[model samples]
Target: MLTRLAISGYRSLRDVRIVLGPLNVVTGANGSGKSSLYRALKLLADIAQGRIIQSLAAEGGLQSTLWAGPESFSRAMKTGRQSVQGTVRKSPVSLKLGFGGTDYGYAIDLGLPLPDSTSKFSSDPAIKSENLWTGEMMGRSNVFATRSGPGVRIRDDSGAWRLAYEHLSTFDSMMTHCSDPHDAVELLRLREQMRDWRFYDHLRTDRDAPARKPQVGTYTPVLAGDGADFGAAVQTIREIGASDEMDEAVADAFPGARIEVTSQGGMFELEMTQHGLLRPLKASELSDGTLRYLLLVAALLSPRPPALMVLNEPETSLHPDLLAPLARLIAQAAKRSQIVVVSHAAALVSALDAEPDSRQIFLEKRLGETVVLDGVPPSWTWPTR
Candidate 1:
């Protein structure tokens, strides 16, 4: 489980570190940088998949994502004695993201590419540095693998540093370029764990949503990000996962409700049977809130849980009465996987607060920067380039 997460030079998260628990609830008002924190974690996951550059580009390039604030705010600036303005940059352009768990930790540093008039991708960001360390915190002595620019090094079995790659591409991550089981076992383990981190954000439940259509039946242990295979996933859960818990979840959300997956010509469709209904309601006929709740049930009851699961604004379109049941489902899922729920629903937040070992992080903006107001942020350090 990731115990700490750190981000810098990214949007309003100029410098933010969060301590995580088995179940974490992140709550904040509008423009409080809750979305920024969620996106930052997604970027970190993208790094292990060698898509960080592409993700940044999708967000309008590094220049647009970088914090639009002074390097530091002095006491006079806070008091309004000094006007807010840009000062001479004391360091190079850098955007860093990292997370640490009990077993290992990883950090990546991205910066502007060197000026190259001949290159059409000059605006692309460069991977300035990457580091992998053992234990919960990263330090010079604990670092087992280090990447500086295009070069990479890993500590040998004898605790001696050796070059792993002389030249890697600026866009490639060491997790993809240099991870070897024998050469860098920790790096490989961390990379695999990162790849398993799942995220679900605003699953579509429109009239023509994919989940509304039947899909080929297969034993799906994991729910797709778009929830297109909603029937297969739920069926799989009923077959091999916690079927009793799933039934309880459905009945808890909708009294007298029972879900079934029907197969016709190899295609599976989800249906829900409820009391006083002449016929069961198919996925296509269910309301948006009902479909979304079922999707969440499928996700939370996944047979193969991920190392981490992040849900963004899960309470959207959900009725207030359902929030309590949703909270119960989330707490149950936390027993199997670490969960981070970013939500604005007070009832949901209050419900989740009842779970043991659950932690709440309240974000607030101060001087255009995101900060944690509930308690002190976790301690962290970035690798030097």
Candidate 2:
């Protein structure tokens, strides 16, 4: 689990450290920097996958994504162009993201390449530094792997820093390149753990969504990000993961309603048998709420759970009435893996808060930056180190 995250020079994050929990919910109003926080986490995940540069480009590059406001606000400051004070000294354009977790901690720093008219990609960002350390926090002594620009270094068993065999590209992550289980256990473990962090954001549940249609049956332990194989996933859960839990979840949500998957030949379809309805409602006939509920069920009850599961604005499209059921599913999922949900729905937040250790992080806009606060038990705090 990621215990702490520090982000600097990233949109609205400024210089911030977020201490996390097993089950964390980030909430705030629009423009409260909630979305920015999510994007920062996603960018960190991209680094482990060797896609940080692509991710940065997707967000319109580093220039627009950086904090738009001044480095610091002063009461004596003026808005006029000439009246405004210009920067005294040049500073490196850097964006850094780091996370501390139980087994390992990692951080990556990105900066713009030197200006050159020769190559079109000269404006692209480059990885300036990265570090992988032991324990749940990062410090100079705990460092296991360190990368400075194109050069890479790792710690040997004798507690000595050794240079890696080959150099890596500026846009590539050493974690994705030099990690080897036999040679670098810590680096390998960190890479694998980071690779297992799953993210489910705004699942396409529209009328055209694949989850809304029948799909071929397969033994799936993990649900796809898009929920395209929802039926197969739920059926696999019933067959291998946990059947009782699936029944209880449906019964808890819609009393006397049971969820089942039907397989004809090789095709699999979802069927929900409710008490009031004589016949089981097919996936096509179910309401948007019903389909969405099933999708959530498949997601949470996944037979194979990842190291971390993230949900962004899961309350979207669903009616308020389903928030309670949705919270139950989320809480149940947390038992197997850590979860972080960025939500603003009162019902969903309230329902999840009833869980034993669900942590709430209420974000508010302050000087165009996001601040996290908690008004409940199991209080949340920022990391001091």
Candidate 3:
């Protein structure tokens, strides 16, 4: 499980570190940087997928995504005696993201590419440094793999640094390119863990949502990010002996309600049989809230859970009564996988705060930067650029 998360110079997260637990609830007011934190986690996942550069580009390039506020707030600025303004250069422009877990830790630093008039993509950021270390905290002695610019070196069995790659691309991540099965075993393990970090944002339940349409049935152990395989995923849980848990989750939320997945011509469809209903409601006939809730149920009850699962604004469109049930479902899921929920719903947050081994992070904006108001920042050290 991840013990800590650290991010700097990214969006409103100018310099933020969060201590994590088995289940974490991130809550903040509007514009308090809740979404920024979610996006930062996705960015970390993108690194392992070898698409961090493209993800950054999709968000309008690194320059646009970097912290927009001044580097530091002077005493005068804090005292409101002077207006906040940019200061002279003290360090290179860098956006860093990292996480430390019980088994391993990884950090990456990104900075503006060196001036190259001949290159059309000169505005793209470059990976300045990447480090993979042991344990839950990073230090010089614990680092096993290090990447500096285009070169990467890994510590051999005798603890001697061996060059793994001499000409890595700056736009690519060592997590993907340097994870050798033999020479960089730690890198390979960490890469796989990162690749399994699943994230689910707001799921659509509109008139034409994919979940409402029947898709070809297959043995789906995990729900898709978009929830297009909703029926298959639910049926998978039933076949995998999690039927009781799934039924309980449904009954807990909709009292006396149960779900069933039907197949026709190799396509699976979802239906809900609720109390006092004339007949079971198909996925297409379910209300937005009902469909969204079922989608959440299918996702959290996944037969094959990931190392980490992140859900953003899950309480959206959910009724007040459903929040408690949703919280219960999330707590149950955390027993098998580390979970992080980003939400502003008070009821859901309150319910989850009562769960054991859960950590609550309340974010607040200070001088246009996101800062955690709950606990001390975790111990972390960034690799040099």
Candidate 4:
């Protein structure tokens, strides 16, 4: 499980460190940077896949995503003696992100490209430094593998350093460049763990959604990001995953409700039988709330859970009454994996908080920056950029 998460110079998050628990709920008011925090975590996942650049571009590029405030507040500015202003280059502007876990830790730094009078890539931001180490916190001695610019160095089994090929690209991450079967076991293990971290934003439940239509069934333990294969995924859960939990989740959400997957040849469809309805309803006929509830149920009851699961703004179209059921489902999933929920719904947050041992991290905006008020704030030293 992740013990800590640190982010700096990303959107409204100037510099922040958050402590995490087995089940954590991140809540705050609108425009409090909860969504940006979720996106920052997603960016880390994208880095392992070598898609950070494209992900940054999709969010209006790195320059726009950088914190719009000054690099840091001066002591004079905070003492009512001076106003907030920029200094004369104490350090280069870089966006840093990292997390510390019981078994492993990682950090990455990104900065704008060097100014080149004749280069077309001068407008792009490049990944400057990345590191993977073995410990809950990153320190000099715990560093296992390090990346600077395009060069990577890893420690060999003989307690000596081994240099990778000297031609790694700045656009690509060290995970993609230096990871091999024989060298850098820590990087390889971390890459696999990063791959298993599942993120679910909003699954489509519109009139044109594919879940409303029948699709060929295949055994899928994990649901797709867009839910295009939701039918197959749920069906697989009933067949191979926890069938009892699947039944209990449905019954808990809607009393006297029973669900099944009807198969005609190779195609599969969702069938829900309610108390009053004489005939079962198809997935296309279910309400948006009901469809979304089932999607969440299928996700939570997966037979194969990931290293970590993140759900962002899950109450977008869900009714207030469904938040409790959603909370129960989430708590069930937490039994097997670490879960982080970033939401603005009081009902959901309260429901989750009511659990036996859940943690809540409330965020707030301070002087145009995001700060995690875990408790009475304390002095924190951010990673030097």
RMSD of model 4, in Å? 1.8
Cα lDDT tens digits for candidate 2, 64-177: 787666675555553333433435435667788888888778888888876778879887888888888876676668888888888888889988988884568888888888
**TM-scores for every predicted model:** 0.98, 0.92, 0.99, 0.96
Taking every candidate in turn, the Cα RMSD to the unseen true structure, in Å, is: 0.9, 3.6, 0.8, 1.8
lDDT, candidates in the order shown: 0.93, 0.81, 0.93, 0.86
Q: Rank the candidates by lDDT, best first.
A: 1, 3, 4, 2
Residue 255 lDDT, candidate 3, scale 0-100: 93
Worst 10 residues of 2 by lDDT: 376-385
What is the overall TM-score of model 2 with all chains considered together? 0.92
Clash pairs of candidate 1?
none
Which pairs of residues collide in candidate 4? none
lDDT per residue for candidate 4 within 1-385, as digits (tens), equals 8878888899999887888888999999888999998999999998888888899889988889999888888878767598777767668878888888889888899988778889888757798888888867777677778888878889777767777757777788888777887888789889889888999998788998888788899998988877777889899998899998989889988999988889899898999999999999999999998998898888878789998999998888898988998999999899998999998999999999998668899999877878888574323334443
Give the per-residue lDDT digits (tens) of candidate 3, residues 1-385: 9999999999999999999999999999999999999999999999999999999999999999999988888999988999999998699999999999999999999999899899998889999999999988888799999999999999988999988899998898989998989889899999999999999999989899999999898999988988899999999999984789999999999999999999999999998999999999999999988888889999998889899999999998998989999999999999999999999999999999999988999999988989999667887888787
In Å, residue 380's CA in model 4 sits off its true spot by 7.6
